[model samples]
Target: MKTGLPFRRPRPLWFVALLTTFVLVLPAPAQTGQLAPGVRGLATRAPKNMKIDGDLAEFKDAFCTPVEYFSFDAKTLRNRAVQFFYLWDDEAFYAGLRTLDEAPANFADDNHLWEGDAVEWYFDTRQDENFRSQAWPTNANPGAVHCYWTGLKGTNIQGRFCLRPGYLNAIPKIMIEVGARRTRRGMEVEFKLPWANFPDFKPKLNEVIALDAELCYSDGGPRIFRTFAYGSPLSVQQPANLGKIQLVEKLAPSLWKACGPVITPVRCDTAWTQNSRPQITGYMAIPPNHAEQIGVIWRNGHVTGDLRSGVPARRRAVAERPGRARHVSFVRHCL
Candidate 1:
């Protein structure tokens, strides 16, 4: 039965040397481009001269996380939509809220602001073992902050914040420059939290901090419905349940995972009615040993046709570099 040279002489050898292919799961270093694990958001660097006037002029380009999840208290969730914006500078961190509430009104002050239409922002500044602990950050815990911001009260157009109870009270009242107004679709509010409030935390590239922004709808009473930037079941009780965001120089237009034939810094925005056509921009990384020519097809859900039909699919690429290529221009039509 010795018909084969080595057909049956490999069981032991193969079992002992099964290393033809392998992969190493290594810890990822801080990267500006790649959206890494456990990092749910990005705090992009803002212009030093950004005027926090409740008008999101330059913030149109800022990173926006749609507020979709509703809290357990929401009764009849309709006609309520929101988006949270984040930006940070050396001196202060900025947050913006664009909500679609037809008749926006909040008449609560300071500690009771949560009862009215307002924002409950939870932030954890710790990067150590205590970061994102499930326990409520009481007075003993100085690693996090819970802030409630209200936009309107009576006939005045202003905003204010109530820092976490029994926490940071030793410090002076947080001077948050506020601007709020009612928009056609809903209302917009903007606030600036100076680094002076979080003295231990500094805004630096790749420095991560946990955060969550919740929007409470009052309808002239106790909060009837609410939404959040990133929903955490325990967030109402603890800062440990919030999500994390890394400080970066620029924002990633899309939250693409770390691995892939990557294309990024893509710019396609709605301006939400301000611009009918958005400039589509992207840069695709050229994998090693790939062909010099690459093609990128652009097709929105509204746009029709495909690569086979060759009617609307537009290819966008530019002169190649050592590792990545700059994307030229793409289709101009957008929603």
Candidate 2:
């Protein structure tokens, strides 16, 4: 049965202003990843609030393990299983989730079903900065970017999928249902999402993408089966800690040869390079005023080798001038 409720918008004005500032400060052509062809990994640009309808064979690694790093303690509900799947057509990227349980899947008492289970989707449209800003600096707030959640019973649903930065806050247009018969399978839920809702973005064929997903469940008495890419505490009021989700990397058509450096290049200026000390070097550079400037570059033995395998060597450069010493220290501080 379909419950026809008017769409609800739940974002506050201050949140909008914060988002606007974030978008304005975002750098141009934000770095993004490539989505791989076929159906093994995440899509290039996943739909905002879509319920995917497909097989769950390929996504075993993503959904099988119970996330121990970020889990909540409530009444323990046993035998809960989750599966994830992703696909892409010419127009949109699709994501599908399936949750299996052995219990009756009750939602009637105090709307317990609505409270027990939730699925969350995080989009990294810009890919580079990971949709973060100095103001918010974190993904705890729903207003930070496009985010959505839906309960198992399909009540208490929230969504945001509009083009005007903050305007993405809107209700989902998908359907959620529970099994009518109580079989050995327990309970199962399926979800589908569309691509149009994701704005100002495009994906190259077979471009790997990065995204995050969370599955939460309650046993009607207490929270159970709570898992997330990142960790969250038991308090529902607290925002989910999203930093834990390991970034999903996608391989491009170019393969390793085309893949850029895994580690970004270091920016070192206002320092000098001196051969006098092999272990402790100097990075020399002319100041904007064209005056002679010199700074020391110190390297720790532990930090050596390719950027991917070992940590980069630490370097510190100090200028002889009075005020310039502080500038060199600031640069070294980053090390």
What TM-scores do the predictions have? 0.63, 0.38
For residues 151-178, what per-residue lDDT tens digits would candidate 2 score against the true structure?
Answer: 3332322221222133244323324221
Q: Give all candidate RMSDs, comma-separated.
A: 15.7, 19.3
For model 2, the run of ten residues with the poorest summed lDDT: 285-294
Q: How many residue pairs clash in each candidate?
A: 1, 31
Candidate 1 least-lDDT 10 residues: 15-24
What candidate 2 gets wrong by more than 4 Å, as runs, is 1-77, 104-114, 127-130, 134-151, 154-183, 206-209, 221-225, 230-335
Clashing pairs in 1: 132-240
Candidate 2 achieves a global lDDT of 0.31
The true-versus-predicted C-alpha distance at residue 149 of model 1, in Å, is 0.4
Q: Which candidate is the best by lDDT?
A: 1
Model 1 misplacement above 4 A: 1-32, 69-78, 168-172, 253-255, 258-335
